[model samples]
Target: MSKAKPLSDAQPTQRKGAPLPTDPGQTGYGAPPPAPLPGAPSTPLTGTRQRGGARPVGWNSPSSRRPPQFTDTTPAAPVRRLPQPVLVSAAVVGVVALIGAAILGYRAMDTFDTVANPLANPSAKQTEVPLAPPRPTVTVTATPVPDAVRVKQNGLYKAGKVAAVNCTAPAVKPSTEAAALRFYQAILPCLNRAWAPLVRKAGYEFRPPKVVLWAKGQTSCTGEPTDVAFYCGDAETITMRGDQDSKLFRQDATSGRIHAMDTLAHEYGHHVQMLTNILISSSSRKGWAKTEPAKLEESRRLELQASCLGAAFLGANKTALGITGQRLETWEWQTKHSGDEYNPKKVRDHGSRKNNWLWSGASFKTTNPASCNTFTAPAAKVS
Candidate 1:
C-alpha cells in the first residue's frame, strides 16, 4: 500500500482511526481460543456480548469458582430404635420357654405317673385298688311297715295303750276323743289278729283292755289330778289324763297319719299284755298298785316287750298296711318307746331308749317273739 509501507510501521503505527482485528487463534500464545457461546453465530472477532455470557479467562476474570449456595433450614434426623440383634435374641428365648412348657404340660396328664410298671412297686401304689370295669354302687333302702302287716304279727294291741285312763263319768272321750277313738278302732283288728294266735297256742283268755283318754288336773284313774297316764290293773282299763292323751293325739295327728298309726299301735300293745294276763305283777297278785320293786320291774318289762311287739307287727305287715305318708314314723316310734323300761327316775318305765331301739330293730329282723325277749339277755347287752 502507500509505497508498500515498511512491514512493522504499516501494520501498527498509524492505526488510531480504526480498531485492529483480533487474531483469536494466535492471541493465546499457542493455546486454542474458546469457541463462541452456544447461540452465537460465526463472525469477525470484536467487542461483542455473548448470548448467555461466560467470563473471559484473564486478569479481570475471577480465578476461584464460587461455592454452592445453601438455605439456613436443616432436615430432621430419624429416631433410633432397639438393636435388631437384642430383639431377635429375646424372641428366641420366649419361643424356647413356650416349647418347654408345652412339653411339661403333656407329661402331667397321667397323674404324674413316672413309674413304668405300677404293679411291680406294691409299696408305691395306693392302698385302694382301682376297680376294673367299675360297678355301680347298690344302695339298700329299708321298706316301710304297714298296718295290715302289724295286724298279722301282733294283733290290734297298741304299744302304749296301757297308759290311757278315764277321767269323767261314762269314761267317754271329749271332742278331742276322735283321735283316741280312731286310734283304738284302728288297733282292734290288729290286736284281734295278734292275740288270736297267742291265745289259741298258749290257751290264754284274750280280753282287750279299755282306753280312757281324759284331761289332766281332772278326775282320773288314780282319783286325783295326777299327770300319770297308765294302765290300771284294778279297773282293767287304761287311763290317760288330758296332759298325755291330748298331747299324744295332737302330736301324732300333727306329725301326720303315719305317726298316728305308730302311736296307736304302741297303745294297743298294752292290750295284748292284758289279754295274756301277763301285765299283773307275779309278786303282787292284786295289781301294779303294790309298792313292791318287783312289781314295778315287771311293769317295765311288759312295756318294753310291747314296744318290741310293735316293731314285729310292723315288720310282719310292711307289705299290707301301706305305711306311705309318714313312712319312717313307725321306726321313730319304736326307737322312742324302747327306753320306757327299768328307769327308776322315770314316772312310767317301759325300757331304756337303747332297749327300745334294739328290741324294735331285732323284732323287724326276726319276727320270733324269742328275739324280743330281753329278760334273758345279759344286763349290759339287754338294751
Candidate 2:
C-alpha cells in the first residue's frame, strides 16, 4: 500500500477521482463525460494471465454470453456540469479546499466525486488533455479455453475466488479530509488482504498495486486535477482525493465508511484485473474498436467487474467493518445511484445506476468473485 502524496505546481500529474455528480441527470457520481465537442483526439485503454498448469487454458465459464469485444478509440471526455445538490453544498464546504467550486463550463472543477464517478470526468480535472481510457473490454464464452486464454474465458470468472477479509474500520468523521485519508490508509491493506488470494485461486502470481491519496494536480491516468479515485495501470497505482466529497460524505459517518471503503476497494479491484491478465487481454481481442457502442459496453464490463470485486470483499468482511443494519442499507442505496445513467450523456461509460448497484448487490450477496463474471453475461446485464 502506498502512502498519501501532495501535488505541487511543478509536479507531474496522474488521473482518477471519486467525483462530484455535477451532471443534470446524474444520481451520484461516475457518469460518462460529455463527448468531445466533435473532433477531439481519442484515447485507448488493455487484458488478463495465469500460473501453474494450463498456463493460458481456461475452465468452464459462468455464463454463455457471446464473446466480448475490444477497442482503442475511446473519445475525448466531454465537459461536465455541476449537479444541484453538490452546488448547494459547496457553499458550506470547508475553506481549506485548495480547489474552488466547479467552474461553469467544461473548463475546470477543483474536484470530482466518489464511488459512482471514480473515472467519470477525465477532461474535468484538466483543461485540454483527455482523461485516460475508462477500462478494458470482455466477451463471453462458456466453453473451455479454445487454445488461447481470453479475458472472457479467463479462470478469474469462476476460479479467481475471493477469500473473506477481516477489515478493521478506522474511526473518523466520514466527511473530513483527515478522515478520508485515514480511512483509505486503513482500508487499503484490507483490500490487499482480501484480493491477494485470487492469484493462488486462479493460478496467477499476483501482487498488490500502490494506492495513492492525492490532493491536487495531474495523475498518471487522467493528467487532471481530479478528485475521482481511479486505478492507473500505467503507473500501477490507484489515485484518489484525500478529501472525501461526493454522496459518501453526504451521509452520516457510519454510512460514509461503507462508501469510502467501497470506493477504495473498487479501485483496488482494477488491480485484480491487472494481476489476473484480464486488463491487457481484453484490449487485444479482435475487432475491439469496431464501434463506439461496443467500446462503451467493454468499459461497462471492466468497471462493473471492479464494482463486484469490491462488493465481495466488503460483504465478506461486513462484521469486521461494522456494516450491519442501517449501515448495510446505506451501501445498497448508494450503489444503485453510482452509474453512467446519472451523467445524462449519450455515451455511457460505467453502466447504469441500476446495473452498477445490481452487480455490486450480486457479488456481496454471495461474497464470491465468480458472481462477478460480467465477461460472460449478456449485454443487458453489463449495460
Specify the highest-TM-score model's number.
2
**Candidate 2 lDDT over residue span 45-103, tens digit each:** 22211112122211322222322223434554566989989977786575424344333
Cα displacement (angstroms), candidate 2, residue 341, comes to 1.7
Choose the strongest candidate by lDDT: 2
lDDT, model 1: 0.47
Error of 1 at 291 (Å): 10
Residue 135, candidate 1: Cα error in Å is 82
Q: Summarize candidate 1's per-residue lDDT along 113-224 as a digit string, tens digits.
A: 5476567553455659776897899999999544223322333232312111111111223225555555555555664565456554544566666765544245544464
Off by over 4 Å in 2: 1-148, 220-227, 246-251, 344-346
Lowest lDDT 10-residue stretch of candidate 2: 5-14
Q: What lDDT does each candidate get?
A: 0.47, 0.64
